[model samples]
Target chain A: SQQGEEDPQALSIQEGENATMNCSYKTSINNLQWYRQNSGRGLVHLILIRSNEREKHSGRLRVTLDTSKKSSSLLITASRAADTASYFCATGGQKLVFGQGTRLTINP
Target chain B: SAVISQKPSRDICQRGTSLTIQCQVDSQVTMMFWYRQQPGQSLTLIATANQGSEATYESGFVIDKFPISRPNLTFSTLTVSNMSPEDSSIYLCSVEINVRQYFGPGTRLTVL
Candidate 1:
């Protein structure tokens, strides 16, 4: 079964705008990871937030985790057209369960 | 993070034929994962490729349809047997490091 579910299924924004995506999961997990996939390409690890950690940052990306709520959110600041892709949230356990994903489109 | 590479970046095969997709990591990794993403669908874990051991497959996936091989820490392969149109999807290989997981470029398979 899929553990995570991302909200807003799709988001359209202009370049330089900030984009936010939310993910909710059903199980207790050790960590939650976010990944981005370009068209016809593989997934690239964007960020990871551990259960004990509330927030983390990497360059333009910020991830916040709320284990109590079983949810997480990814914030991309100053988004660009190249950022258009499918973003997924995966919860780690014996195996990782990925969210349905949110497709973000940055209009140039 | 490890640099992962997959062979046969993409392929078009006839139904009933089998194709093996190979993944090679630049460095050693203890755990490797295989995933399949159907068109416009989320990724599903295929199996956990443990070096020198039989792979652990996910529910709804079996060793028969998708056979996995992990010869060592840096190399693994997944084969799609008796391919059908439904088997066409993007196959990816992944490995984790310091809590972050990296994926291969993926192999795009099309069965007709």
Candidate 2:
């Protein structure tokens, strides 16, 4: 069974707009990480938020973790056409369990 | 961050045949893992490949079907045996460094 579940399976927005994706998990995790996958390519690590930490930021990416709620969210600020991709949230433990990704399309 | 690479980015194979995919990391990593992503689905762990040890298979996965080899810290290989149409998926290899896992460009396999 999958540990993480992401909502709003797909989203579309214009360049410069902000995009957000949410994920919920079933088990306790040491950390939660977000990844981006371009079409036909592998996953690229985005940001990681530890259980003890509530928020993290990296360039245009912002991630928030709520261990109490067993949920996490990824927010991409000032989205670009190049930002079009599938985003996944994974719960980290002895092994990382991935969620069904959310596909984001940023139109120019 | 680790730069991981996989060979034969994509391939088409016939049923009953096998295909071997190779993963090489730019730096040595202690834990390497293989995952399968069926079309329109999330990634599913196939096994954990550790250097100098037999690979650990996940539920519903067995060595005879998906054999893995981790001869050293920098490299590993996964072989899909007796391929079937249902075996078509993207196979990815990832290496764990600290708490983050980096993935290689996946091998897209099509079993006919």
By TM-score, who's the top model here? 2
* Cα displacement (Å) at residue A30, model 1: 1.5
A22 in model 2: Cα distance from truth in Å?
Answer: 0.2
Instruction: Compute the DockQ of candidate 1.
Output: 0.71
- Please give the lDDT score at residue B67 for candidate 2: 94
Model 2 per-residue lDDT tens digits across residues B1-112? 8999999799999999999999999998888999999998888899999999999999999999999999999999999999999999999999888789999999999999
Candidate 1 regions exceeding 4 Å error are none
* Clash count, one per candidate: 0, 0
Query: Where is model 2 more than 4 Å wrong at Cα?
Result: none
User: What C-alpha lDDT do the candidate models reach, one value each?
Assistant: 0.92, 0.93
TM-score, candidate 2, is 0.97
| Candidate 1 chain A: 10-residue stretch with minimal lDDT | A89-98
What i-RMS does every model get? 1.6, 1.2
